[model samples]
Target: MMKKTLTALLTVISLGLGGIGFAAQGFAMGSDSTEPAKKADDYTKAVDLIDDEEYAKAIPLLEKSIKEKGEYADALNQLGYANRKLGNWAAGMEYYLKALKLEPNHLGANEYLGELYLEQKDLASAEAQLAKLKAACGDCDEYDELEDSIDDYKDDNNIN
Candidate 1:
């Protein structure tokens, strides 16, 4: 009887540990409502590269991630960002447009695209993107950053 109780207690402990393991995995893969779960290894590496300001190195990884994950909006946004940082304006715009096509409410894409417009001195286009960002996420960092960029651009250009 003692041996049976010991076995049962071990089984219970094992089951609890299994549950915890699965939950941890879910959290690591970003199981949240705001963003989709991203499980691509290349995507993660590319994000790290981008964080380090290695835009050129991040491009191929981002491309591989898109190929592996089937064109996720976040990956496309990162592609746009990398290209923009490298001064590939047309390519950056194309990637941003693709990302927006996939996920219209993508905050990063909107904010970055707005900045791109500002770079080209297209204040109206930039403002349009800002409006989209505001509609997508009211009172968010992306909105505030884009708004500040717009203000700075206007100030520098003497727009008003």
Candidate 2:
């Protein structure tokens, strides 16, 4: 049921620069993208591995995508998530932060990074990441919901 739960969030999910709540499904990466479509394909494959809960297998594929296109921020963030799933928190966060640097307003980066902080019970950092998501996703209708979720998480964890 974890995949189902995640699929709901990923349906129109995005941790992107625009915060526009782009769908991470259907097209895991841009299909008809004129620029480096190969990278997109590769990224999609990496994501499929993640969805299947094959984190270790996904890592090399993700790394390949990154190698092909160093600026593939999407792959970088996913790689971070994959790392986190494997319980390598530090390396996972490093990739998340790296992706964030490339895309400052990336929603996924902020959310996941906040989650990392929350896991560690670092309320301040978690708050900062979640707080910034609002501004980062200025046009996204889901921001309200996502904000509420983060707030609830913080509250449940006694973050404040």
Candidate 3:
């Protein structure tokens, strides 16, 4: 009887350890998989479209990239840019916000979202985004771009 109990206990312990091992492996696979490579290909294609100012063509590709990779910050930022270029301000803001949530230091999102605010005549919010970009990368292109935009906004509005 004691031997049977010992055997049963060993079986249970082995099963428990096996379950833990499986869970750990699944977690690693989920996080460190090569799925991003496929999504990155889609993202690169979308970026090419965006560069051509073909926002309508880019949007669907960006959407696919984000859907496949989940919380893909660059894809989300590009989606925001495409939507904003298409004059879909609300949708653009939503995408930008999602990108920021995923990576608060996302340079593209900060710059593009600042541009969106400027379009909406929200100088204060635009300046806030500029500050965030400055905090993230003091001398980066994103900061310079947004700063120039804000300067243009001020000059255009004669805000002094």
Query: If scored against the real structure, what TM-score would every candidate get?
Result: 0.82, 0.68, 0.76
Clashing pairs in 3: none
Q: Rank by TM-score, highest first.
A: 1, 3, 2
Per-residue alpha-carbon lDDT of candidate 2 for residues 64-119, written as tens digits (9 for 90 to 100): 87787765567878889899999999999999999888777777777778777766
Residue 96 deviation, candidate 3, in Å?
A: 0.3
Go through the candidates in order and give each one's C-alpha lDDT: 0.89, 0.75, 0.87
lDDT of 1 by residue, 1-160 (tens): 9999999999999999999999998779652122544537787888899999999999999898778668878889999999999999999999999989988999999999999999998999999999998899997999999999999999998888
Task: Give residue 86's lDDT in candidate 3 (0 to 100).
Answer: 92
Estimate the overall C-alpha local distance difference test score of candidate 1: 0.89
Backbone clash pairs for candidate 1 read none
- Scored by lDDT, model 2 comes in at 0.75
Q: Highest TM-score: which candidate?
A: 1
TM-score quality measure for candidate 1: 0.82
lDDT, candidate 1, at 52: 99
